[model samples]
Target: MTKQTDSMSKQVETNKNAGSEHPPVKEHYKDSLEGSENNSEGFLAEVKAVKRFWSPVWIVPILCVFIGLWIIYEHYSSLGPQVTLTTSTAEGIEAGKTRIKTRNVDVGIVESVELSDDFSQVILTARLSDGKEDFLRTDSAFWVVRPQIDKSGISGLGTILSGPYIELLPGVSKESNNTFALLDAPPIAAPDAKGLRIFLESDEYGQLAAGDPVLFRGYQVGTVETSAFNHETKKMKYQLFINSPLDNLITENVRFWKDSGVNVDVSAQGIRFEMSSLATLFSGGVSFDVPKGWSAGQKVANNTSFRLFNNRTNILEREFKEFDPYVILVSESIRGLEPGAPVEFRGIRLGTVIEAPMNINDEQIVKNDNLVIPILIHIEPARFTELLGEQFNVVEQYEKGNIKGLRASLKAANLLTGAVFIDLDFYPDDILVQEKQTFANYRVLPTVSGGIAQIQQKVMLTLDKINKLPVENFIQEATGTLETSKETLVALNDTLHSVNQLLSNQSTQELPAVMKTTLHELNTTLEGLQPGSQGYSSSVQTLQRLEQTLRELQPLLQTLNQKSNALIFEAPATVDPVPKAAKP
Candidate 1:
């Protein structure tokens, strides 16, 4: 260690001499430090002066702030208006999932659903699209669309798969709104839909519902929107819509009828069947038509009212006018006459029977001098107003008692049915007019006796002839006459016997020859009167005269047995009649 120390000391001395020759290490380091300091100080001064506010720190912070603000603005701008809707219930709805649609296009979403304060209805809060704020209005209608099957028809079929949705039919209002009442059911037709609205009045309110078609000339032109019964009016009111130009067909005089089904009519011509369409068969409909030879009248205004007929035939002859009443007095039985029996004028319908035959309950019956049946008939002159000009007045003629030869008669309408009707005819044969007396507010018109009356009069005449016969006196006279004739016949026979005896007595031999000559002359006369000769015709006439004389005598014999014609002729008896007080 000592030797090393001595060597080091010698080296140290040498090194010291070397350090003195070179500059000291501290001095060199100090010079280098000064030069570096000078350069750093200048560079530091230049950089400090050139510095600006656009540094990366400032730029990064500013960018971060701008991005945050943009994000916040986008979040706020994307939000939409909130709307509240009241519904009967919130069935088939989810707050976030339920969508509001217009024509199947999403317009809004349900933000929340809760019960109302009264708990009577469900309140729903929805967020509508940004620009759709104007769509929410006082008149806009909203309803929850779900799977529905009803009498009207099936609807919301898409809701079965995609879930329930709120449907909105926008209104025509220009004002904006945020709250709305939900509809329990969809409208038959949108209130703002393009159409013309009209009303119909009917006595019968048929089973008609919303969406029922309205037909014109068998083509569907519109729909029935609603129907209600009016208690005060005792009529059914139907609200309807006719789309577009089809409404132009409606007029004041147009007639509407319920299209129930096929109509069949059996008339003199043939059977007629009318049908609108098959759709009308299932769903009830209304049909309209205008009568021929009539103007269409004024255009149908909004909610114009019309009467609804049950069928087409009823509307054909619906108009009727008042009539004048007349009473017909009949002497014959009016068994088959009844109220509503037609009163005809020469095979033309003129009136109807209002009251059938009944016993007269007034002094007129006593004056009539016959058991009379009074029939009341109503005559409507308007039915024949065209045929009978305005100057022809029935009342004036009746008052004048001339009625223009109009007279009433009873005639058989149906022989088998025993039905009869009043027949008014112009009785030219009996035109002597007489004053008509009023009875029961009706003019008393004379009725002519029918065919049956003539038979009755003839029977009465025959009965009178039979009653005039003096049958008892004729029989008594005939018996006396026959007795007298019997006595005369016996006396004549005795005379004939006496003559025979005298001729047989003596002096007849020569007389017999003379008698033969006379007989020969008689035979010659007989031969001349044979057939094919004028003498034969004269002989026949003589025989006829003798037979007529015999017939005259025979009446006396007939008077002895029969009494029918005893009083018809005067009978002369050969002997005096028996005394009234003669013995038995």
Candidate 2:
């Protein structure tokens, strides 16, 4: 208390000095100090009344904590659906590097790659972008896209530099899926492609497979989507997709056939060559078209079914509806003849051979006396309808012609191939005719030995005649003639020996010298008669003298022809003629 009072007195003394110097200033300063003290007290009061919830020093760390939580939420919210993919191989795939793409746009990334539990397959876990979750639909396809060369063509060429990636083909299915089996190859058609889908059923697989082209005429407009063999039906079933607009070409009457690309047909008519394109030639293809004389029918819808014919000819052969069946009994060997061979009228195909040597058993052959083979053939009257008029009935005509010597004969269709066809023609000369015969419940068409069979029969008959000749008597006569010939030969040998002996004689040896002398003399005579020889010169001189003498006798011969006594009195007529000329 004493120290506080001393300090207060000192301050009062200093204030009194300042007040003595400036009294107004001293009073103002005392008032201002009192107000400041009050303000300071209020400030202290306000500071004491407030409560502290957090420290400013912790602002950074607390903000960091909340920011981290927000970041984590954002990360989880941005993530797309995760999918599992199973494949046979892990080639060209990486856990984090490989991407999933659709239409060349990346939509996801492979999160990890691992083997299946059995280690038989590769499993890929992939996460798609937020909005791309729809790509995981049931019908969607995933395949590893890499550089590949195949019969279809070179594909995924862009993967060569950018590296292989997974391709996602979004499906049209409404259902979604998280797990999928990767395709070994790319699908032939996009899942969402607008087109008509049809099924083809075939007995033989042939060269058809997925990715083979489907052609209309010769233009490719679609692809074979799938080729599967059905075990239950024992037939090959193919799924096909025809692009829009062109898909309209498909109709009920249209027939589908395996287009081997190159069609080479060799028959009795000749060789026919047809080729669609080089692309089809290598990969094979299917072609559809309405057969001749048929309407295109109604347009086919998606999922429609059709029968796949083996070839165009097979389709044509089965197109006709009305036909007549007949059985022909052939005695000739049916070698080179087969089912499906043409039954022709003249040269035109009027029917097809349903079966050759039909239903022949060992017992039947043993009991049969003639050993004739039965052939079943069906003649389509439609083939002759255009030629014989629409009213033409093949069955009635065949029945009528049966009595008029109509016959079925085996004729070689192709000489080189030895393929024979049934030839129906009239044979009025045929003697053995059974007009009302029936074989195996079918009307019989009379048959004759014709074509190569007729030639063979004639040859056999000739051999039979030759075999029946008088061989013993002919041999005896031949022996006598041979003896006479031998005697003649011996006489000729004797004559030759006589000639040899004569040639060995001296006179005969001199005969050559005589012949040589005679030849030399003849040659000399011929030389003397040549243009520069003495005989030629003498003949020329004689001809010249005779020509001059003939010229001299010309006037005398003329005078003798005019006068009877001109030989004795020719000099008088010349003087008389000269005197008449002088008077003129």
Candidate 3:
């Protein structure tokens, strides 16, 4: 373009001169392009010059200082070093928002949940406050406290949804890497983390939840951590976190059952136990009591078997496989019983039953194509054991020796529902009172012990009594008396026949007249002898006696004459009329 301008140089020079004259327009045009390369270079140079004069090296240091301060603040204020706490109670506990507090001061944050190496306890990871280095103790007790209930009594079931608070019991052990145990509340027992995991099954009343109390002799000894259903076994599984101190108290003889009332059946003795109370109306719990003397202590009964019973269902479970009252294994027969059908022990209510889920029994019985529930019965071992014997004093006083007063009882079992009852002083004469169903082949139970054995003996004695009565002698005596009465009637009938024959014979009738004359003569002689019989007075006496004798004969003749007249004449038939109707 420049070369082309050569020819036009002269023109261009003239144009340039013109352009110079119009410098304002060119400048204005250039100025319109505010971002022109030349202007941009000049602006850059000016900026460089100003920077060379006034730029500050101190600014970088200041900024660095500020950034460091900010980093320090973040490090100090943010959640601290990560820590983990394991507790028995997940109750009253929440994640993320839960805080681990030491003397009411926030110490750490719950990070996450993890499984312990032993697989016994739940591990909760937490980030402790940066400055808080010491809080956990080796012997620090940990428990998750929520609303709970057990053998000891009913308590909170309230803390489940609420967040958990960590209570740090500062310890003196200086080990840097401490076993930071969890303390949800006061510990029931020191955690013996023996790596033992056990389960229990119970109903709403019988169930044990996390943070619920576990007790021995009414003293809290452990807590519940988690509850679940075991699909493999098909029963409920509740984990009991035991304290190290009281865990050993559980003995082979230590049996567990539900706290709610149920009917218990003692089948052989025909005894039933049914005790009801208001507490048993709704919720249930677990309870236990040792026999008066039968104990399984002195050695560890750790692997001992436990029995589960449901009085309501009348089911007895042989094994409580990790379950207390929850593991009641009902026989299929009892399992089929309807709800509200009572279970009785010697005529008393031991419990009532309900429909339930599958159980841990390897051999589960099915009926009617429906599931067989694991029957659960609520029982307070303490309360249940108290009723076996009566206060004998009352019975003793009731029996007065005067009339050979016999106080006997007959134990009977309900035929329809299998409940049992005791009939005190029942009269055997009333056969209707006894159950009609009887054993085809009756074999006595192990007549073991006191009043029960006496009852059995009495029953047998009654059987023998019917065999000793005298039926044949009474029959023979009745026959002899009937024979004698028959003879007497026959003799009387023969005598009447003879009299009729005499009346029919004319000659015999004449003989009757002669007998009458003889009787009159004898009467006259007797009267004369009794009156005066001297020679001179004899004649007079004879006359007088004759008159007296005639008078007596006259009365006899009159009677005979009347009888003859009646025989000769039939009496007239006449009807007696009612008195004339009163003047109507």
Candidate 4:
């Protein structure tokens, strides 16, 4: 068989060299057998014939085929679920090159990018890796991640060099979805992060933004996750995330406020500057704390709402409870009585002024016709609410107290500082009754005459009295009196001069000696009328009475010479009260 195989092989080789078809099998075998008899060893003669369509030599090509089939299967099987995202614009995206990532992990690639039917938005079709199709759920969020700088802070910095990509935040739901609207910017904080979300509402947004820190005391415990303006409420709503454990600190009574970077206060105490943190200076932040004097309330539920105060004091002032309101009708200046000023009962503050002073015009004049300053004051019962008990309503109690002479007045809280506050007290006699007497809403609290007002009124009255005095008439009367006195003094001086010349003459000197002798003779006769004599007693009594009469007449004569008209017109009584001497 070996000789036969060799002869056939040789014949086949000669046929391939000649580039010709093989001869007939009968002739070829005959030629092969003849050559086999002359061959040295017959290996083919010892081998048995096997009937198999597939041979061992065919294994190489079959294995290659199997590998090719496997590669094709894998190419299709490994392909992920396709998702389409609609974006505002296709500025930074490129088909087949852009990728989708979650927490920086590459999970998908963009397959194609096309504009919508309306050309208003760009649609992105992307293929997510196998087994990740479950991530596309109802709550799934997708946004284009690119370098962005906003009031919140710088974000997507990694995309600066690597180009833009789509970011995905998987939802918590079991359900799945494919199509989604792309966000213009990334979500403030990842929704899937383990934490709690609470909302805050404010009238002003200020520098607050997403990704700003949420602080407890001065340390950052969480962040402001998202924010949106609510038109219905006319407020800006913010979503705050507090990381686990620390979130336990939040209670129903917790007060939240914006950390407006730098805190500066210029007061009589001087300027004070404080900063919560450097991060807050850039991105701004939200801070919260349980207000003092209030118990830690119940643990807050997720998405609980609270007010976002603009300053720290506002949060601290949350303790005030406005259960009632009263209008302080001030006639004096309210220069320092601004809104938010404290309203005190005695020295303790019980409430605050919620609104600015309102002016009330009137045709009727108060005293000197001054327009009254009407201010709306909100009085909180919380300060004394507990003392009054829960059964009693503060508004009702105030109305009752008002009838008992509870009044509101403005007083200078700080004279040097010019700060004024409302003082509520009981002034029974000075209860200013209002024309409209009803406690329907805010009662009009009566105001007493302030100290300053009384002083002003007294000064005005004194000036009026001074204006009514008759000064002109008095001056004329005094001038006439002085002229009469001048004439009398000139006449008296002439008489005195004449008497002096007569006494200086030689004959007048002898006349004074003769008068002295006559006086001596009269004295000798008077001496004979001794003590205890009726004549002597009568003389002494008469002399004493005459001296007393002269002394009384001296003041009467001086007044008669002076402004006698004043004594006649201004005296309380013109009739003489001094009794006449009795006739005995």
Question: Among these predicted structures, which one has the highest TM-score?
Answer: 2
Pairs that clash in candidate 4: 3-36
lDDT of each: 0.75, 0.82, 0.49, 0.76
| TM-score for candidate 2, residues paired by index | 0.66
Sort the candidates on TM-score, descending order.
2, 4, 1, 3
Off by over 4 Å in 4: 1-79, 102-105, 115-120, 147-161, 181-191, 265-275, 319-322, 355-373, 386-405, 412-420, 426-436, 439-442, 451-584
**Per-residue alpha-carbon lDDT of model 4 for 315-364, expressed as tens digits?**
75664534567776678777766777787766666677766565444423
Error of 2 at 303 (Å): 2.6
Across 1-584, the per-residue lDDT of candidate 1 in tens digits comes to 34433544464466567765323433443454455575533311111124366666788889999999999999789877888998787888899999999998999999998987888998899998888877778778898888888766798898789998999888778887888888767776676777789988887766566778898878989988778999999988998989988889998878888887677754322356887678788766888889765679988678788888777765653344678878887778887777767777666666778788644565465445776777888877765665676445454465575555667888777765667778877676766654456776667776687655666689999999988999889999999999999999999999999999888877775788889999999999888888977899988999999999999989668786666556776555558678688688
lDDT of 3 at 487: 99
Q: TM-scores of all models? A: 0.47, 0.66, 0.34, 0.57
Task: State the displacement of the C-alpha of residue 265, model 4, in Å, after optimal TM-score superposition.
Answer: 5.0
Model 2 ranges off by over 4 Å: 1-76, 112-123, 157-163, 172-175, 268-271, 319-325, 360-368, 386-390, 397-407, 425-452, 468-584
Q: Against the true structure, what is every candidate's RMSD?
A: 25.9, 16.5, 24.1, 21.5
Better of 1 and 2 by lDDT: 2
- TM-score (C-alpha, index-matched) for candidate 1: 0.47
TM-score for predicted model 3 compared with the true structure: 0.34
Q: Which of candidates 3 and 4 reaches a greater TM-score?
A: 4
